[model samples]
Target: MSSHLLPNLTAAHLFEAILAIALVFSCLLGLQVIRERRPPAVTLAWVAVLVLLPMLGVLLYLLFGTRKRWELRVRQRPVIGCETAVRPFDDAHVLDRMLRRLALPPALSGNDIRCSWRPEVARRDLLDVIDGATERLWMFIYMFEDDASGALVLDALIAAASRGVRVRVMVDDLGSFGSLAAGRRALEAAGGRMVRFKPVWYALRKRMLNLRNHRKIVVADGQVAWTGGRNVGDHYLAAGKHEWLDFSAVIRGPTALALEEICRNDWRFASDEPPDSSPVWVSGPQGNACLQVLPAGPEYRDDAWQTALVKCCFEAHSRLWLATPYFVPDETVTNAVLTAARSGVDVRILVPHRSDNLVVDLVGRSFLREVQRAGGKVFRYKIGMMHAKAVLVDDTLAMFGSANIDARSLFLNYECMVIGYDAETVIPVQAFFEYAFARASRGVRTIGQIRETLSSLARLLAPLL
Candidate 1:
């Protein structure tokens, strides 16, 4: 029983162990700080996973982060676009057929559409229309960059609300982070209300980081609705980045009601309020152009908008025009394009020669060979970036929205878009597409093509987009 015989633990050993634990905890805390403003729940979840299994937890988040950002289609259908224009809609006859194949109420044109070439112009005119109203203004956007242009829109909402207009706003956590604090302050000071969706802090499995609120719309008095690819930011609004080009469409009718429903759902979800059913949506008369709000979000139906677009792409009997900055398509969508093109559909894809997201551009290149082999032609816009997200099928049916061709737009983020089948409405949209097309150059992507084939890793990540 000699005390000297007992093994003595050194002070240095204890100190080293303490330091290691502190280091891990410090890393976890630092990540949370960097991510900032995620939902309190998300932040806590991250903490729990990391605390429980630090190294594995970190690895899991990295692998899944990219996938988590993508909104994957939960179901598939043969066709999804609603043909609304009576005279121009060749596909309207398929409504009865779709009732069984797609399980969606056959859509018909019930709204007036006004297309704007620039996102900033769209933003101002939309705010003006919503501000001009006395009843209510609902503004929902994925990104609200902290810049002068964003302030202008915020001020417009403010002035409207000051005059007794009920204004509600929703902004996503990830997109708004870099510019959120200032925007939030101004909104509060203006007597306007704003809520951030899914604020996740850095930890393992950061809940809100990948699932963004990507929908952009402004619904006023249930009469006018604005939807498109433009987020509220300098680049999208072409505020600082004069070269940035985007598209948006204005809607007025029962379809507008559907957009309003989406905005209401977003606002309520983002807000602190216990959601009450958005006052019974006031459906309007069937207007000249038929339209419907196809939605895809976590709280709502999954990838319905995406499924609709892919189906329409397959059904394109004539020309297919697609414009998106990011072109990373999941296999199902990629295969759909290939099938349509292989079947002799005249498919053309328009993408930016230089996009803000380089990885996305690379991921898009990862699919060129197959699309090209299927008789699809790809163009890279050289004049400026093409941020337009629209599709024209047979020059009859058309679509516009925040949805990108990439996995992020379809399955991961909250996306909203409109489908219409009016030559009256779509002719102008087609003309707009042609204008952008004229400025673009046919891509001779030998380098990109080879690289794409070599880099199977990127394409493997496509479904997670």
Candidate 2:
């Protein structure tokens, strides 16, 4: 054969080899996806993508599809000081029992729970908690910007560290990249340590880029704790006119110790160093409120927080109110919400008119319509970006924390929430919801054809998102 002919033949063989490898990889991925037992829609989507676009599907699966990371789980230390001795299955409240069964901390009474709906109040309380830290301070925040609010908190942390307080900070690498450098250096210079949760480069190398640490927790001296959807930024602190509507809760009791344990576990996971010995303090009931800390992440076999939230929805007899910035719920949660609404429970969902994420906003419209059809009320906040994640069931239970009502939060990211089952906690959350509802416009029961078509298309890609 001629030289040109031989070269062409070699190129053709290389192309054929690539095709065979792609086909084999796609087949293996399809089988693994099925074996993972994901939702039917998600599984089918993955299978179809692999069958049609094998190479791209394989890359996508590696980056975003892989859910479980056994290494992370193995490296994580066991529950140190948060586990309950006896199962609370016979508890009066079904949610309490269910949460205990899921290995969450038991609800402890006598905790003083204070919820802050205003951004400025939450910021002030957080800074005060930091400045008051006499022994140790731990913070696991998703977004720690270098703006005014961040600077203020960093200054507090630096002062605490300078005064011989053990300060440890953990922030998401992707969420707070380059924003924490100055803070970290200053903190470290003052005898503190700061670490990133799943650094971007490391996550990419491990093929776990989608798993983010979205938890926002601050525990000072193991006596007081602050947690909620609010991160460390000017927008969250209401420094500007376009502030995001958010809230955080302060708890003083054994519940604070539980949160501190979570922070320690997270810090250990990110820094690969065992947490320093905790200061010894008498942890007793501080007030009349009962609170439990529910933490969820990919390290666990089941989605504990999602299961609890769905259980709460089904258990709601009088009312169920949810406030989330993102609302792309999965099938189980959607069904729970619809069932409650159909059963004559007052089901109301509050979301922003337009969230910061355009795709999430579009996808959420479809889910919101489903709720509306099931006799649920949808309230779209119009004043500003609603960034709070809160849930109120009946007049007794309230939950608020970092998890959004979306797949990424409920399934992919590390999240934490405080569940309060008493008048004190419920009343404050109810007031927050009432305030938001008053400002929000009711979602229209009808949609135009063009908007409905776009929403329909967006719903199809919801599983991937």
- Give the Cα error of residue 278 in candidate 2, in Å: 8.5
Per-candidate TM equals: 0.77, 0.93
Candidate 1 lDDT, tens digit per residue, 1-465? 446544454565776787677557647664753364332434565566566766556655553433232233222222222322222334453422343244333354567778888666776777667677788788888788777677777778778777877778887777776666765676677667878776755422444466688888888877788778887766766544464778887777766666766776666555676555423544545467766556665554335656776777777888887888888876667878888898899888888888887777777776865688789888888866778888888867778888888766775678777777667558877887888878888863655656556666666556555
Model 2: worst 10 consecutive residues (lDDT sum): 74-83
Off by over 4 Å in 1: 1-108, 202-206, 238-241, 278-286, 448-453
Model 1 scores worst on lDDT over the 10 consecutive residues at 72-81
Model 2 local distance difference test score: 0.85
Top TM-score: which candidate number? 2
